[model samples]
Target: MQLTNHDAANPSYWQARWREGRTGWDLGGVHPLFSELMQEAHAAGLKPNARVIEPGCGRAHTGAALAKMNYIVTAFDVSKEAVDAAKVLYANETKLELVVADLFALPSNWSNSFDAVYDRAVLCALPQASRPSYVHACAKILKTGGLFLSIPFTKLHISASEGPPFAVDEANLESLFEADFEKVCHIEKQHSVKDSKIACEMLIVWRKK
Candidate 1:
């Protein structure tokens, strides 16, 4: 599979998927790994009211969960349809701010604005070449010494010709974050996904330096 900007693996392609309700990637709700990570963060002394942002926050389940826990949660997605769905899903929660905005083109008013950023199915969703800019944007929006928690899909079967859920090995993941973050904890774990076990989901928690 040739990984290229012209491939069906770009952001516009994902936007179209959401428009057509073809988002197999939409898990309908929060992933269990996220819940476990939040539990760990709480145990590690993160306060309830921390400012949190979720980029590419499709359906914003993580935002909803954080809001319920009293965090000031903000979430954004480039696809307006996805944002609309998230709003409907999280309507009763006043603690979260859901906006339709491109991750790379975030509003100028938001620099250094968040205490922590949580991402799942966001970074790895992008085409491989676009990841560096995505990482840079995440770093820019995060406050100095803030936290970044990511659950990225790794070791997925994909040819260069196919993907929206792109694969990331340990080396690729490290190359994406090591320059911008102070690595804190990295875990490679198996996750139960419906009828099968996904053996290569990696969880990374980083403290912005």
Candidate 2:
């Protein structure tokens, strides 16, 4: 909600980052924890062929990984450069679909359309003010009882740093999603961003109430 000319939550901010290859956040691969989540989802009766979404998908690496596992995946980014990169990487991937779109302005028909919605750093990238809208959109697009896999950058809150990768602590999460979601698990232990400046992160899985 800090209105500023350089707000990290702004789409133009990310677009510039993509254009300049300043994506320090890109792991050059999918989030390490996502593989485990996919396995868990499968064991929880989520069929590999079921639909999934990767909102704010940068380069769509997670979507590509899911597609390889036979999941029907749709990933989108507000940055055209990011989406273009994803298209080039998964040009022949039938299970993966990448689109240039805003998370807040998603297609209306997508309501309750996904079996799962995955987030790894996307919410962290937004300004604190936008997190509510982001949460609402994610909830709107997921089917009842669908998983909400969130692995957010927790540095600003935990380590006290400026962020795009903003500060989102456990308390902030509780206040944000408690109205429409039930935490399926406790706020997880701190984890690393893997070879990055971010000291740690928080993991939480939610189920729509």
Top TM-score model: 1
Candidate 1 stretches with Cα past 4 Å from truth are 1-10, 43-45, 195-198
Q: Candidate 2 has which clashing residue pairs, if any?
A: none
Report the lDDT of model 2 for residue 97.
90
- Write the residue-wise lDDT of candidate 1 on 1-209 in tens digits: 33343453355765777877887766777887887777656654568889999998889988998999899999988889989999989999889999988887899888898888988877777778888898899899988877888877777655544665676778887888889888777788775455132347877888777
TM-score of model 1 vs. true structure: 0.90
TM-score: model 2 vs. ground truth: 0.89
lDDT of each candidate versus the true structure: 0.79, 0.79
Structural similarity to truth (TM-score) of each candidate: 0.90, 0.89
Total backbone collisions, model 2: 0
The CA-based lDDT of model 2 is what? 0.79
Any runs in candidate 2 off by more than 4 Å, and if so which? 1-6, 156-161
